[model samples]
Target: MTPLAIAEHAPLFIVLNPASGRGEADNARRSIESACAQAGREHHIYQVDRHRRLQPCVQEAVERAKAVQGVVVAAGGDGTINAVAQATLGSGCAFGVLPQGTFNYFSRTHGIPTDTDEAMRVLLNEQPRAVQVGQVNDRVFLVNASLGLYAQLLEDREAYKAQFGRRRWVALWSALLTALRGHRPWYLHLSWHGVQRDIRTKTLFVANNALQLHQVGLPEADAPEQGQLAAIALKPLSTLSMLGLLVSGARGRLGEADSVVSFPFESMTVRPMRGHRRVKVATDGEIGWCAMPLEFRVSPEPLWLVRPAVAPELEATRQ
Candidate 1:
């Protein structure tokens, strides 16, 4: 079917990941249902299997939502949101979210309420609008995607969270401790904006969402949706140097570290200079190995993200 008119009212189909927010997402279901009911919304909620693949379930839910103008709501962490968002791409389905995850980075970034009841009320009252998203190969990440140190940091953070529980600050602290053990740099060949460059850096962040940058306390990276993305690459550094970078970043002085550099671009291709055919990549808090010569670009078709009526900077980002 052709894409529906941009303002069509649709029934909400929420795909929730029960394991997100350390089972807090599951606990929030009653509140979600109650809010939906009180708001007089026709909504269906699904809890996908946590142990198995989520994309298929997400696809099926979005498919079933076609009758009501194909609106799907992702009700978990960034990973779950990413899956549903990717599936929504090109399907003409408007997507919404309830920030039931630890960080709720996407939710907070878009001015959606973090409280489930408030979020549902907002969802019930709003219509989806187009917004830009980043694509790396076949995957669409609602937040930033990265390789090298950031990927390892996500891996270590998840490990720590699985062991110590799913507190956002704790995950950050644990990742810091893991980074204290040191990191290795990868030589990369990056081609973007008609330039080819070489760099040995511990992490390369392709940021398209401002809140993710805010989470890292970078003022320069707070708005990546101006038709370009911010790419930051850090040169190899010792553990102490990394710590200094972190501390300086917390004080809004990331430029004080000489090993760091960043620029904005619409698209770029990155490949490890080392002869590896694939590398570990992290997207929206999900970690996995992706093939070499990765292509990262902002998708041409803007996703119709249904934001609350009072979304922060909605006017600014929709530009």
Candidate 2:
């Protein structure tokens, strides 16, 4: 398929979350409209409201975009991107992002500029490229997924974001508070690489984004680029020990921590050994419950992302 360009005739179906962009949905909408108009691109904007309308909105956009061979764009944070990506998967519609969140990991990693105007321009001028995706059960995650303490930390972070604000410092502070509080270990049975073991852990995190892993100092940061998922498990720890582990992660030396178990794999099965049939899981910062045992793996198909062409040097390294 030809790449979408500024002079292209295909339409763009934009899914915008009003809660994102620091509640400046109007600004995002205007920027999108202005860009599309200047480019003479046909486009449709679907606003995702607070009534939990993201799924239906995205589905509608996906169907429309698919019919016209247009792009389905996500103009929000990670949660919004995940929602749109989930619907666009297998729809044969290229996905675009207009990063409007505290952390734009997916957009930044893929070279989708966080600036709304710049992102819109890229959407109009880029081709769809297949990118790695991680899955937990049936849900697709573009960044990471986890349960146990990490999952709890996500929930706590959201609460903190609501009370304090939605900023990086706020998120970091919330994580510190969550980690400083003692957490109960999760007794889980893990099966991976033809091996099965039972372990007590504070968290079991599976990463699909190499940039995030590298930022957190995990040695298996290259797992995603190698077509595999990276798993990080935290052993049960004292409060101070947990604090130390957090520091290690912040310092990009998490793999060097004794309490950390890091590995790369194509698949892993985790079951609650404590008779719990359901567990809270966080995917791309969204908290939800999934039935045990949880299955984490790389998706068989990639998410067709709309971004700038990869540099020849980077492409060579990937090959």
TM-score of each: 0.91, 0.93
lDDT of 1: 0.78
lDDT of 1 at 111: 80
Clashing pairs in 1: none
Q: What are the runs in model 1 whose C-alpha is more than 4 Å off?
A: 1-9, 50-53, 214-223, 313-319
Q: How many backbone clashes does candidate 1 have?
A: 0
**CA lDDT of every candidate:** 0.78, 0.85
Scored by lDDT, model 2 comes in at 0.85
Tens-place lDDT digits, model 1, residues 1-319: 2333433345678898887775776557898888767766677878877454577779778898765575788988888888888888878778888877787878887888878888876677776767779988777877889988888888888888888888879787987887787677789999998999999888898888875565455545645657777888888888788888888777656755677888778889997788979888888989877888899998888877887545574344434
Model 1, 295: alpha-carbon shift in Å?
0.6
Stretches of candidate 2 exceeding 4 Å from the true structure: 1-7, 50-52, 311-319
Candidate 2 colliding pairs: 217-252
